[model samples]
Target: MTPTTAPLLPPQKPFDPRTATIAIVTFNRSGLLSKLLDSVLEMEPRPGHVLVVDNASTDDTTEVVEGYRERFGDELVYRRMETNTGGAGGFSEGMRLAYELGSEWIWLMDDDVEVIPDGLARMGRWGERFASVQGRRYDFDGSEFYWQYRLSIPLGIPIPFAPAGFDDSGYREMNSGCFEGMFIHRSVVERIGLPDPRFFIYWDDSVYGWLASRLTRSVIVNEFVLKRTREIKQWDMGTRHLNASSDRYRYYIMRNRGIMQQYFRAHGAYRPALFAVGTAATFAKEIIRLTAVERTVRGTSHLFRGWRDGLKIARDRSFQTMPPLV
Candidate 1:
């Protein structure tokens, strides 16, 4: 009997910062976005281009960006959306633009973060070990931000960050991603097409990262590269940190589980009963946090609304349009 196996792909060439394009997505955070743009200029070997996707900010976001026009000169490309697309849609739009520009490396981030001076250099030193590379971030108080993850597909969770995941390599495999500081090679984008914009906001990065993991090497390196600028009240949960939730967050967190389940099924990881249990636990946790931590039930209606819509979303056929694993 003869056996056949697919051939292994060769290693990609080392990463080059000059071939990179910085894609920043912002809503109305003009003050924070300006600082991020300032940091971009501070990069010793900055990316060749910077693309800012504005989700139709009513604030002086356009003016803030224009203030840096002379400094950025032709290096900056600003495209303002007609409407707000949330984080999910904005990132998708920004990524699509970067890809179409024929960029070799696309670094995705939000307006709330500023890359540490020389951050790209430290991370770039990794030299392309993984196609999708994530840099760590420091919280508003200069504390370590809890961002690393080992996603549980059926359980629908990003397990709390653990130091052991990094081992001796100073990097760890991750099946989830954060738009705050994700540096993805063009090949990963080419393989996955674009992030599912239907997500609109939540769980979008995880789904995109999951696909990247399935197709190639995806990792979060130990280097501290970003500083989160937005300050928020957070509850310390031993190793991980949870930010106070808003009604918008509550609704999206609940409703997006169904969208999450759709992609899980597309990836052959769906288990309805298990996912339902996970969803229920999530609902319980949010409710408890609402009543105890925040001491208010004002957002309860949004959670219920999102959950009701989520159940309906789980059964929708729109998921079929998502690309299959390569």
Candidate 2:
């Protein structure tokens, strides 16, 4: 079940509609959300629907969304969750609503990110051109605070340049790692199911990409649509600081990674050795950085919490989903 396989869509399929519904999951960043929505609404092929899922924000997020709704009307669907479901839950609910509302596809973007150079419209074109293409995402990590993951080609071959034309079978042969920017197709969604809510945060997108790669073809386009938010601080931590740090961030990474491993093993596609190597390297990097930033035991505890919680969650299923962040 490679990613290139056809998706399981229902019968009586209509022509592939160019329209896509954009889902923006927002918390308390009303200013950032307003800016994000403004740019998205201005796209050339404006999304057929703009759906916003507010995660129980305490600030003026409601006011901002209402303003957009007053103007956008039927073109937009704004929803408020009874509790703050975190990013993973927000995406899950938003995607579910989009799928139910007859959207041909879904374009997911973070609330804090701002559109640049009309990237959304361009990415939508690319998604249409190569239905398997996963769209593009890049971080504005600044010069000093940068982060990038190494993408390895098969047989440990180094990929120095982009391949010509996505039509080449080898292009399909090489797997694409999922990053932030994603343009999800209907076929892939129908086959692979929605984003895993159990993955409250962290590796949820990566797990989805890995799963979609197994169920249907997926590739990450190099185009940059949204910019990583820099101005906003950690104001939305809310009352569950422990939940945010312990359960969501640290635990899910380990828990989901193991879950994914078990799933792939059942499918006879287990790559534990490869995962082990990658995980070790990642852990090493985090330890070195954490120690350098603050060599205290407190710092170590904060840094290693993800690893600790991930292990705990992997062992206990009850910890997978926290008590709905109200």
Q: For this target, which candidate reaches the highest TM-score against the unseen true structure?
A: 1
- Each candidate's number of clashing pairs is 0, 5
lDDT of 1 by residue, 1-326 (tens): 00123211214666578778899999899999989998889888898789999999999999988888899888898999999988888898888888878787788999999988898777666645667888888889998877746787777877654463466889887788888888887767776778777778878898888777776667889899999999987677756766678898899888999888887887788988888888887898788778766877778899999999998988898556455224
Q: What are the models' TM-scores?
A: 0.93, 0.74
Best by lDDT: 1
lDDT against the true structure, each candidate: 0.81, 0.59
Which lDDT tens digits does candidate 2 get at residues 6-73?
54322233323335788888899899899888876666657778889999999999988888886677
Name the 10 consecutive residues with the lowest summed lDDT in model 1.
Answer: 1-10
